[model samples]
Target: MSSEIADAKPTDLPKVSSGSAVVIHPRWVRITHWINVIAMFVMITSGWRIYNASPLFAFTFPPAITIGDALDGLPGALLWHFAAMWLLAVNGATYVALGILTGRFRRKLLPIRPMDVIRDLSAALTGKLSHDDLSVYNAVQRLLYAGVIAAGVVAVASGVSIWKPVQFQEVAAVFGGYDAARFVHFFAMATIVGFLLIHITLAILVPKSLRAMILGR
Candidate 1:
């Protein structure tokens, strides 16, 4: 079993056959998903630039990965960051609202029990998880997607606190203080980025998932 598992490759995973393709992703979902991709790119890159201005830690993001200029009071990065923030906020709200209104959330991501997650995770680790059903999300997928949405809310809240410490003193106070809010914002961003990496990796490994997103199959 160990040797068989070691010999397994990503390509060996179960895939959704092209002949069995169906509408797994709706138009609204596809649109929002792509918008999110672009918005997140701008936010993350511009965010890195903003962080370089007065970094919270010892190291800084590399210029190659970062966007905008951080010089002269950080106006460049600030503008980009704010713009992306609004885009992300509006789009994310719409996605969530529509998801709930249309019952997509309940249909696709509901009933994510703890035992299901443990069972699916164990199967995944043992290379027994299947990706043949593109229309349904596994327990792990549901948990991660739901967690990321919650993380986005946290990121936005913490960001608002950091952005307007005086105006949003109440919000900042909820996070302990202005300085503490920055930590929350940083960690939330990190969580989102980590989720994106895993999400993209899985999409690549399961090409049908990417095709479904792009072509709405």
Candidate 2:
């Protein structure tokens, strides 16, 4: 048994090089991703600017420190925020539609089986998992992606709550109240910020993965 184990050929093990180099992310995915990036950036910046209005959850700072004095006065920022919001919304909707229409959603994003999720989770828990270990997404990756998407939706909803508090009184009430909605929005933004840091760290840890996103290899 010892000899057999020692003499086993490396070919018996899964090889990353054997993986296909086909483009995983198509043009639409790339376009939407970059658009979302820009939109998120604008939204965060403008959102911070808007935050300065009443400093919802914290002390109010001057316009010089923040991006804008008020959401309304910062017309450029407001324009950017709203425009980006529309772009992000439309691009996201298009991506979802295309994914469903093309069957890629079922084929790629969805997990293969219950066992796959278990296996991936076990590997991740053991700290033995890598991006190569996943053809699409590991359990943790899928969870995070799902989480970010959900959070995005919530952020959009809460944004509406804040945008038209009078009109969206019911929606605002769902988060407890306007102040509560503001707190939730801020917390959700913080969550995204945390995810971005982790995402960037992982991207750095795996340059090939980052390259894959860029060149769609």
The number of the candidate with the highest lDDT is 1
Residue-wise C-alpha lDDT for candidate 2, range 1-217, written one tens digit per residue? 5753464355322223435555656667677777878777777777776676557655653555434444455666576677777876787778768766765555555554567778877986787887773336776676666667768778888877877889989999988878788888887887787778877888798787777677665
TM-score of each: 0.87, 0.72
Which pairs of residues collide in candidate 2? none
User: Any runs in candidate 1 off by more than 4 Å, and if so which?
Assistant: 1-21, 70-73
Kindly report which residue pairs in candidate 1 clash with one another: none
Question: Candidate 1 at 20: error in angstroms?
Answer: 8.9
Measured with C-alpha atoms, the lDDT of residue 115 in candidate 2 is 79
Ten residues in a row with the worst lDDT in model 2? 8-17
lDDT of 1 by residue, 69-157 (tens): 64543688789999888899999999999888766776678879999999999998898999998878999999999999999899999
Over the full model, what C-alpha lDDT does candidate 2 score relative to the true structure? 0.70
